[model samples]
Target: MTRRRPPRHASADELLTELGRLTQQALERAELQKARVELAEALQRELLPAELPELPGLRAAARYAPARHGLNIGGDWYDGFPLPDGSLAFSIGDVQGHDVEAAAFMGQVRIGLRAVAATAADPGQVLSRANDLLLSMDTRLFATCSFLRFDPATRELSHARAGHVPWVWATPDGRWGLGEDEGGLPLGVLAEESYPVTRRVLPASCAFVLVTDGVIEGPAFPITAGLDEVARVTRAGVHAEPAELAAAVIKVADLTGHADDAAVLVLRHDRPPA
Candidate 1:
């Protein structure tokens, strides 16, 4: 049997040098991650609408908050604008992720919805066309959305949902209820999903609330209870301004310690001047 040579051992100085090099590399990687996170946050801010439009008799306000325990970026988004035919459109959605890619995809979805709504007559058509648009994109992510078209002249509210949570509304008489409307599959799930529209006449001086799941559901909170709590809050603030009501609704997420991003949109209808 051949005798093996004595094992050569590294000197302490050489080991210390290697340790220092590793430590430097770790610090550099941490800095790089921080820079990337900052960029993502900036992109998210740019993707969201800076201000909601205020129509003649309708007032709108929206609020958004990042998760308390993540990269501080997510796919939750809310938008409101006037359509070409003098109707106002509002949308709230959550893309399936909590990263930079999700935020970018959210922007794309919002743009697609706007393009489709420009000519689409009702909420259902807008969501259907937008769903097709999302499927055509080279992405596997999906999203849930609630789209609404309000005709101020008739007080008619047309809504369509795509695997999204129920909306809450409060009438001027202090009565509140959840939407619980029929919905289609989430966007990007199928090639051409048809979202059925639900039409109802909103009472004058009514408050309509739309929110992402993050606002109502948490690890420690059940969704049913959360929905009830939101309804109660809406009832209490039925007479408040749209901005105040939006703030009050978003505050629920902070109290629940939710781990996902939260978004809330409040639309209040006041009878046009008498």
Candidate 2:
């Protein structure tokens, strides 16, 4: 004899009612998630600088954009701190992931870099020590950073980059150049890699624009396209103030399709007061 199939567990109406209940539960859960995300975004915004440092003979501005995912708050930070010798240390960095954990790690990385910079007084050495510190931390997390040491008195600037984007320097003579660094892998990935150091004497009226990759990549435009757009927009306004220039570049990214968090730091040397 043929075996009979088992009876349906629930009638059509019953199934629909169950599904409605499930949907309500999911909606409630989503509401909770949204609240958490709002809280996180507010907290992350607090971490960002209230105001860019006001250094004599310089104009500086910074911007940090949070990812649209809502749950992902990647640590994209810029800071200007002073070293023991009175030189200003400027830096921008991004921790690997976009979440609460990443934010915390970014804070730690910033602190470690500051400590190393104060102790070493060399751009390359500071990054090297930061690399070691990252390697010692959680193995999965990594960070890309660009560190700058600027001496306003002497008009000297030294830099080191770790897998970060190229910094653009626009000159008073209407020429633009990319900052040169030997470059190395992002921190926390390798145990003993070394970062290269480079220096330059920024001209009066010259400005350096440093940015994170989030300013460039998304679904509509590829990374190269975003970068090219940045170059084009930035090259167009080489004489604008640091803040205006940064806003211009970021507006292009926003228009293009920068889904992830983006950060831009502008440092321009100006004439000293009489």
Pick by TM-score: which candidate is best? Answer: 1
Clashes of each: 0, 0
lDDT of 1 by residue, 1-274 (tens): 9999999999999999999999999999988877766766777789999998877778999999887764646689999878998899999999998788888899999999999999995999999999998888869799999999988778898999999999899987767889999999999999778999999987667998888989998889888877887898899999999999999999888767788889999999887876
Pairs of residues at least 3 apart in sequence or in different chains that clash in candidate 2: none
Which candidate has the highest lDDT of all? 1
Residue 197 C-alpha lDDT in model 1:
96
* lDDT of candidate 2 at residue 182, scale 0 to 100: 74
Candidate 2 ranges beyond 4 A from true positions = 2-6
Candidate 2: residue 151 Cα off by (Å): 0.6
lDDT of 2 by residue, 66-170 (tens): 777766665688887878987888889888887777777777888888888879988888988999988887568899999988887788889988998887777
Candidate 1 Cα deviation (angstroms), residue 245: 1.1
Model 2 RMSD to the real structure? 2.3
